[model samples]
Target chain A: MSVLVFIDHSAGQIKKSSLEALCYGAALAASTGTTAEGILLGTVSQDLSELGCYGIGKIHQVASDTLNNLDARVFSTVLAEAVRSTGANIIVFSNNLSGKAIAPRLSARLKAGLVSGAIDLPQVANGFTVRKTVFSGKAFANVSIHTEIKIITLNQNAFPLTAGQGTAQVIPLDIKAAAPDVKTVSATQSSGQVPLTEAEIVVSGGRGLKGPENWGMVEELARVLGAATACSRPVADAHWRPHNEHVGQTGIAIAPNLYIAIGISGAIQHLAGVNRSKVIVVINQDPEAPFFKAADYGIVGDAFVVVPKIIEAVKQLKGVA
Target chain B: MKILVCISKTPDTTAKIAFKDNNTKFVAEGVQWIINPYDEWYALVRAIELKEKDPATILHLVCVGLPDADPVIRKALALGGDEAIRVNADSQDSYYIAAQIAAVAREGNYDLIFTGKETIDYNGASIGGMVSELLDLPFISLATKFELAGSLATVTREIEGGEQTEQVGLPLVVSCQKGMAEQRIPNMKGIMGARSRPLKVVEPVTADTLTSVVSFELPPAKAGVKLVSADNPAELVRLLHEEAKVF
Candidate 1:
């Protein structure tokens, strides 16, 4: 049985998360004595052979314009057919927006066991057991899939990418595709800012910044640090930032490497989403702010005073004006 | 319009998580249970708002769990759901839960189904998509904003660096998160009314579970905070560069 990894792309380029998934699937294939292959649904600009360095042997490309925009049902049907024809028992996907949308439906269609948010490779010595984060990154659960076909979606940035010198053979697959049930009307493009979910470093602000007018320092720090900008729920709720920028239990959950929170009280809801960050830094005037307890490094000071110095330090460190 | 809101009971956000039985099971003793924040704060609240907008809307609450999950269902009804359905299944497998939900949705012929993006406990985020596929309905996952006008519904969902707005017909499923609606606290009258609302306990459909839990483990704890005085903010950067090595 071979391992099939879903390679997701946007604007004709493969997403970084897909590379992580590719590495994870390759490692799993190596451990299980199976070949690692990939399936691409839409047209991509990247040379399929170059991705061979990630250890994938072959890539099945379905160049359908309709596949460009993700439709969970349509994608599931295509993937189910691919799995049937390829005899791939293990499927892998990145547990991102598209993965979350498609993996579960695909699981239903294939009647396969699925483990989403998997953080580790399966323990295959005795049985195929996968470990995943649950309770909003509070704990891990080891799930054993007994189904003939099993699926796993890896969390973003969970696996390290290992590169090897190699080339992959690309083959085209022809399949009957269906029109999507849902129709897209419009899309608001995000600016050049880093994607919060995929960003390695993030600078977040809460109500402590006081209002939207005081957001300049937060943006400056984020720019200097080369980090994405995020906010607590209250800031978003109060319309100081767009709802999409909110990062918390009720908002987008992110686990960047460096999460710098300025003037934000660390609420449990907020922690549920960001507790997985590699290192947390909090800057607040109140020393008793609960965020300090969860942070690796903390500064008890006013945001107005603390953020500029951090930004200046970053600029000086990076040799920028 | 008929809507089915899916809910689950989860440990409170601050609950001290512990595993028992050699880490084979999650310890429930002395744990405070509440309606999953996402379910109560987003999906159910949005369904209630839609019902308020149009009196013709009928809201139903569904959960796949044992009898102990009834209180969670009651809380949903108290928050404005008209009726509730509890599928007596103990398995936390998404396939099993989706099978049970699909059966009920088929029996009820509900037009719109809403579920939280994922339960906080399992964080599987799979049931809505699985159930939609099972029922052969359109599935929209991680919908932040949902609005209905006549038979067509408009939705806005998040992408990596952007957002996409889409439109779909009725009889679809959506996994909801923030921006859909605000939270609703159950008032005295609503709580009183929930006590009388009918909660039907149904049997689950026969389905094979694809996965089983081998164990539950906790993530490594964070080291105590290392404070860097705000006056010397450059030192914080030094530690991040020299020690944390994140930059």
Candidate 2:
């Protein structure tokens, strides 16, 4: 029996979270005395063989044009069948949108013990136990799964990717496709420089930005750093930024590597989503902002002046003209 | 359109978070329990919107709690819900709560189930997903906006750095978030009307629980903030590199 890793893709390219999940699954498989394989659904344009560097021995590609879109039920059904066919004893996924939708259903279907938001490798001393964040990253919980098959959804940025010199065997798999009951009529997207969830660095603005017109510096800095842009809930509600850019308790919960908050007094609601960041930097002229209490680093400054200078310096550092 | 909106009764946001006599349980003395704020935004408001589109639509507010939560359930009824259901059971675990809701959904023959992305109290975003699994239906979490037309529902969810639009068929579960609708306060007329609406309290069937919380504790306090001079932006950057090691 082997460990199965689900590779997430969008716009015909694989996601960085998938690579992290692949490495996590590979490491878990090694500890469990089993081999790790990967499954790629939909039509991917990337070189599937290159995934071998993460220690994946083979890739099962379900190359169907219809599979490009997401239908949780359909995806769960197809993935369950794939697991049975491959004799995979453990299933792994990135603790993401698709993973959140599919893993629970798959767990119930297969009667396998499941865990999400797993932050570390499983402890196999006596029984298989995995560590996960609970209470909105406020604390950690150790959960032990006592099923014949195990499933885990790794949190984003929780595990680092491993690179090595090897080529993985890309073996295509034949699976039955189910008809999706849902159809997309129109999709409205927010055009931006960085994808917030995938960005290594995030530059967020809050009420301190003052008005929508003053957002240029935040965008310029994010652009220079190749980081995604985010806003506190109040900023989004005021329409300074689109609703999709809102990151907080009521908004999108994120766990990027570096999170920089500007002009924002961190509320408990706002902190719930971003407290998981590896390093948090708060920039607010008010030295007493609550955000500074939780920030790993704090800079007392005015965004209007400090942001422009930071952007210019970043551009100069990156030599991006 | 029949919509089932689920709300959880919890302590008010302003309530002081603390432990009880032995620092094991949440302090509940004199704490006012209100409908979870997130659920009100994502579920109740969206349900009202659906009702406005189709006046014939049936909107039911549901909760799994004891009799003391009836006032909050009545408050939900006053907020335009035609009916309310009290499961008469404490939501001890996610699995048990999901089983109770799944049973109710099956019996009601509801087409769509709506809940907050996660309850502020338990914060177990698990029920909606688990309920969908038990009911054998599609589930979507953290939907910023959703539109239902011609038996197909399209939902947009915020992902890490980006957003994704998903289309799913009818008879699905959706966990609503901000942007679904603005919070609505109950008017005097609605409050009077709620007095006569049907509020049913039923006992919950015993469900097999797979997990239990052995203890609870508060998160450790964050370290004190280190202030950096704003005059030298370069100094701040240097400190991030040499001291914080984050750069």
Candidate 3:
């Protein structure tokens, strides 16, 4: 049996997380002594063969316009059919927005075991077991999949994206597309910003920023550092930032290469979301802020004064005016 | 309209997380449990708002847990659910839990189904999709806004870069998140009323437990933080560049 990776794309562009998923699937397939193949449901503008650099040997494409927008029910139906036709025993997905919507449905359709938020490769020498984050990254669990057909959704940024030399053979799969019951009324795309999930660096602020008007410094620092801007729950609740920017246990959980928290007290709920970052930097006025304990570096300072200096320093380092 | 909102009980957000039984089980001792925030703040509250608009809307709460989870279910009922159902099973398997919810939904003939995007404990973000698939119904996940007119539902859900608004027919499932509705605390009157509300305990339908936890591990403790003088922002930047190499 072969391993199948769901190559998720939006507006004809493949997501960065899917690249990691492809790499992960390829490695898993190699370990199991089987080839890794990719399944693309919607049409994309990029050359599908180029994706082979990520180690996939083949791509099963169902190029249909109707499959472009996410309709979990319709997508799952098509994927389930593909899995049966391709004889794929292990399915891989990047646990992003689209994957989160679709993977569990696929598992149910196939009666396969699913482990979402998987952080590492499965151990196959013994029974197949996958390590995944539980309790919102506070704890980890090694879950064994008993079902013959297994499914896993890899956490974004958890797996490194490795590219090597290969060309994927693109084979068109003939499968009738299901008419989507969910009609897309409209879409408002966030343009000209690195999406939080895919961002390598994130600069977040809490109530210490004081108000929405003072967000200029935060944005300036983020812009200079080429990082995405995020916020704490209180800031989002107070309308200092949009709810989408909230990153915490109750909000979006992000694991970036570097996460800078300004003015945040680092409540347990807040730490639960961002504890997985590779390195954390905390800048706050209060020395007793709980965030300092979890941080890799701490600067006890006022956001108004410290942020602008950091911005200037970053700009100087990047040779940006 | 009949709405079924799935609720889950999880450890309190501030509870001390630890393991028992050689790290195979979560330490439940002295751990206070609460209704998962996503379920209480978004899913059930949105259903309550809908019921407020349409007086005839029947709101039913469902949970897959043992009797220990009853208090959480009762709290959900106090929040606004007219009735509640608890599947008497204490399993951590998401597939089996979804199967139990699907069984209840199939028998109830619900017009709308709501679930939080994910539980605070496992953070699986899985149940709604699995339940919808098992029931063969359209599923909209991470819905931030939901509006219903007749049998057509207009839902706005969060995507990777932005937001997308879509319309679906009734008898669909939705996983609610922030912006769907504000969190509501049960009033004394509501809490008293919940005492008399019908709480049904039903036997779980047999479903395969596809996965089992072999072991648990806590994240490694962080090394002590390296403090920098507030006036020395440049030094901090240099350290991040040279030491962390994050840039």
Candidate 4:
């Protein structure tokens, strides 16, 4: 029984969430008394050996540009072959967009029991049970996978990335790439911005901001704090912000280290997406806003006045001009 | 064109989540069930829009649940589905649900299969991929925009940093999310028409149940909020730095 972690990367750079998956997978392999390995499909510019710091003993690379763009069918077919050749009984993935697409297809192909949005390592002592978030983070469910081969997609930020001293052996695995059925027509990349899923801190605004014209303060505050900017459902619905920047039940769910809400009243739908944040701070003029109940710290003030002040304070504290 | 749209019944977003039966089963009492917003607002609505563009298009809805899921299916019918199918089984395992839908898809031989990105309850986001694999068809997930021309379908899906538009052949499975279509309310005529729509109930196909839930637990409650006066914005910053230590 061995563990294999899928190393997800975008444009040759490894995602931060994959580093956490490596840590989780390596620890799980250690607890099970087996070797942990990584499988990288597509080309990566970074030195593969550097990833050993996350605890994997070896990495299997399938270096081909054809494997770059995510085609779930082709990726799953290759992964199923990798699982067979490596004799791996368990697989781990960071539950991001790519993982969400490929993991289940792989699970169906391999007839392996799969669990997504897992918050922690499996309880190996008792039949390989995994705890995952359910009800949009409102509740948790401990799901037991009965199949011999188990698949788990770890939630983003659920596991901390711990670096250690070691170098992983980078072995090139020879596998024929399947012809992708999906054809890529055009691709637009959102560059130079902190991706919301990986952001440690997020500054989000809502309808209370009044209009899209007032969004400069939110962006200024996020810039000073080095945080990503997010918006509520209505903000996105009204086209005040892009749908990708929307964080709510129907949008991207995040669990940042610190989530600051400005001019946003916490609807249950909005709260469901962000309740998992380690710390929540709400700034709204209405003290009766539902968001205060879920916030760690709150200030009943107009966002127009309050956000700029907080931005100045953050700048002063950080010694930024 | 025949399109099969998959939907699931979930507790209303505002419903208070609580588990009963030793935390193994969700309490069903006093809970209002709605068609998962993603399925209703995006997947089904997009299919309905396609049907509207071409009156020859046949739109069907498939769901996997017990009788209680019927009302949710009816709501989708009211929204614009021409027909519905409910597999006579209830299971939390996504693979099982996908298998049932795949069976229905296989029987119907749909030109396109649609499902939401993920249900609001489990947020597994696995069904579309699994069903595509089961049917041996191409699958695109989290599609924000979809347009079909002849046998070729153009779909734009959300990727890690941005978006990617892909073209694929028909008999495809695509999971819908925001930006695919606008949400529509059912009028009196649509509601009355939904009652006469045929909803076929079939026994579930044999599929392995690979996972089982052992227990459920709510998230730990917050200790309570600490309020700082608006005049003391700097104090709030200090508390965030020293007390929270988030940075």
Candidate 5:
């Protein structure tokens, strides 16, 4: 029996979360004394074998044009068939949007015990048991799976990426493709300088930016840091930024490695979506901003003056100019 | 359209979380239970929206809980749902809950199933997807905006860096999040109508469960915040390096 990892991708490119899941799956397989393999759906130009550096032994590709876009039902059905065909006892996926949609379906199809938002590998001294976060990252629960097969969706940033020296065997799977009941006629992609979810660092502003015209400093700092830009709900609601850029309980949730918030009071609703960041630096002029309570680092200074200085410092530190 | 909305009772967001019985279970002494916030925002609001679009549409509310959960179910009915179903079995696991929901959906012949992106209580976000798999239907999650035209439904979801819009056929499952629809307060008429609506309580069909919760535990207490004077931003940086050691 093998461990199967689903590689999430879009528009012919793999997502960073996929790599994190790959490492997680590889580690789990090591503990269980089983080989870790991966399954890639759709067509991508990236070399699948190169990802073997993540410590997988084999990579299975089902390169079909129809599989380019995500269709949860179709992907789950195909993956279920792949599990049976490859004799995989464990399946792994990143706990992102696609993974969240597909993991449960795959579990029901395979009758495997499933865990979502898992923070660590199963404690496998006895029967397999995985620990996951509950209550929106507030608490922990240990769940033991009694089934013969198991599935887990690892939360992104929960596990650090580990690299090894090896190339995986890229074997193309020959399985009958299932037709998708859904069809995508058109997709409206968000046009932005940085993609929020994939960015290593994100510089977000809140009402503290004052108005849309005063956003220049925030943008300058974000550009210097090579980070994506975002806003709180009030900024979005005020139309200072698009609603899509809002990151809060009512907006997109993100967990970047470095999250810098400028001029925003962190409401609980705002905190709910972004509390998972690795390092949070809140740069608000308000020392009393509730976000300061959660920040790992805080700079109580005016964004207008402080952000520009930080940008200059970063550029000098990087020796860019 | 026949839409089924799933709701779960959860602790209020502000409730102080604690553990009892050697940290094996949550302490329930003084906490108040309400409809899961996300479930209320997505499932309840979206159901109301659909009902408004088509007055003939039927909206059913379902939950997996004991008889005491009837008040929560009635609250959902008052929120404009037409009928209610409470699976008599207490949900011991996510799989069992999904099975109960799938059973009801299949029996009711629901064309669409609406659930919150995830319950605030467990935050598993697994039931909607599991039920979709069981029923062999398409599942879309974290939908911000959705519109149904004829037999096709288009949904917009927020992905890592961008947004994706997908169009799928009928008989679909969608896990709703914020922005899918606006929140609504139930009218007095709707509240009165809810009191008279038929709430069918049924036992869940037996299904294989793969997992069980062994224990629950509170997270370790966070170290008290270390504050630096505003004049010394560099001191703040030093604290991150030395005191917190998290930078």
Candidate 6:
């Protein structure tokens, strides 16, 4: 049995989350006495040999420009073929936007038991049991996969990355790529913005920031820290921020390394999305704020008075002008 | 056009979460349940908006669970669904739930099948994709905007650092999120009208669940917050940089 990790890339470079998935898959393969292999669907600019440092023995490249647009059906079909050709019993993907789109379809197509948002490797002593976060990160569930071939999507930053001195053998994967029924119309992209889903440090604001005009400090803090900017649902609804920047149960759920919530009253809807962050900092004036219950650190202060100082301190720490 | 909006009953957003049966089961007693926010604000509401634009379009609601989920179905109908179907089964397994929904959609011949990005209770965003694959139909997940014209449908979905707009023919599946539509509350008239609407209960399609839950556990409670006095705001920064190590 072999383990295959899907390498999701954009603009010729591999994603940080994909590297986490590779390390997780490689460790699982080692624990099971199997070799880890990787599959790259679209054309890549990075050398395939760099993947060997993550413990992958072989790298399968299906170099095609058509695969770059990220049609879920086409990707799943191509990935299913690669899995079959590589004799992989277990397939792994980072639970990002691309993985979320393709993993379920691949699971249904290959009749493989799938566990998305898995937090840890599976236990092999008995049947393969995977631990995953459920109920919007409020609870954990141990799910046992009973299928012959298993598929797992690891949550971003859930595993440690191992960099070793090695290189993998790259091979060409031959497969019949079919066009999806869905046709692309147009793409409106915001270039150079860190995606909220993949952000390590996120500085978010809410209605307490008062209005869109006062958002400069939040953005400044984010800029100084090289973090992504997010907003609460109310802020997005009131047009203080774009809908894509909203983070909550009804919005985009994110799990970053450091989540700095400024001026946002910690509502349950918002907490469900960001509670998985490794460190949480809530900056609100009210001591009774519900968000303080979940925060690793808290500050009782006014956002207008507090954010500027925080941004200045960040600049000082980074020695930026 | 016929649209079937998938809905799920979940614990209220503020419900205090706890486990029972030695942490194997969720405690449901005393907890109020509501229609999942994504389903209400995006999938079901978008379908309602479509119906309002074109009166000929029919909106139906489907849920996979026991009778306890009917109230959530009724809530959907009052908001705008014309009818409802409750598949009598436990929805803990996403694969089995998708199979049942696929069976219902096949018989109903829905032109459009819509679901939320995922259910809040399980956070398993797998049903729509699995159902689409099972029925051999095209699926789009997390569509922010869906517009239908004749036989073609335009779906705008958010991707990494961008938004992707795609066009697909009818008889496609989509899971929606925010930006699709605004939330609609049921008026008294609509609530009374929903009481008279048709709610059909159908048996589930027999299938082996690929994954079974062994147990459930609450996430470890966060440590007590170390409050930094607001008088010295820079102190918060120092804490984040030193003790927290977030930077």
Q: For this target, which candidate reaches the highest lDDT against the unseen true structure?
A: 3
TM-score, B chain, candidate 2? 0.93
TM-score (2 decimals) of chain A in model 4: 0.98
lDDT of 5 by residue, B107-142 (tens): 999999999998876878889889998898889888
What is the C-alpha DockQ of each candidate? 0.83, 0.43, 0.89, 0.82, 0.57, 0.77
* DockQ result, candidate 6: 0.77
lDDT of each: 0.91, 0.81, 0.94, 0.93, 0.83, 0.89
Tell me how candidate 6 scores on lDDT.
Answer: 0.89
TM-score of chain A for each candidate? 0.98, 0.96, 0.99, 0.98, 0.94, 0.98
- Model 3 chain A TM-score equals 0.99
TM-score on alpha carbons, each prediction: 0.98, 0.91, 0.99, 0.99, 0.94, 0.98
Estimate the TM-score for candidate 3: 0.99
Candidate 1 global Cα RMSD:
1.3
Top-DockQ candidate index: 3
Kindly report which residue pairs in candidate 1 clash with one another.
Answer: none
lDDT tens digits by residue: candidate 5, A1-321? 889999988877888888999999899889889999999988788999999999999999888888887888889888988998889998999988899888988888888889888888999998988998776666789989899989999987788888889999999987777888766655666555778766768889999888999888788877877788999989987889977788876576677877888888998878767877777888887778998888877788877767776776667655665
lDDT of 4 by residue, B1-247 (tens): 9999999999999998999988988998999999999999999999999999999999999999999999899989999988999999999999999999999999999999999999998888999999999988888989999999998999999887689999999989999999999899999999999999999999999999989899999988899999999987998999999999987
Instruction: Name the better of 2 and 3 by DockQ.
Output: 3
Docking class of 3: high
Q: Could you give the TM-score of chain B for each candidate, in order? A: 0.97, 0.93, 0.99, 0.98, 0.95, 0.96
DockQ of 4: 0.82
Better of 4 and 6 by TM-score: 4
Which of the two, 2 or 4, has more TM-score?
4
lDDT of 6 by residue, B1-247 (tens): 9999889899998887888898888899999999988888999989998899999998889998899998888888888888999999985878888889999999899999998998888888998888888888888988999999997999999888779899999899998999999887799999999999999999998876989888898888787888888777678788888887878
- Write the residue-wise lDDT of candidate 6 on A1-321 in tens digits: 899999999878899899999999999999999999999988888999889999989999998888877877788889988988899999999998888888998998898999999999899999999999888888899998999999999998788777987899999998878987888899887777788888899999988888999989988888898899999999999988999999987788888889999988898889989989999999998888899999988888888888888878778888996
DockQ for the candidate 2 complex?
Answer: 0.43
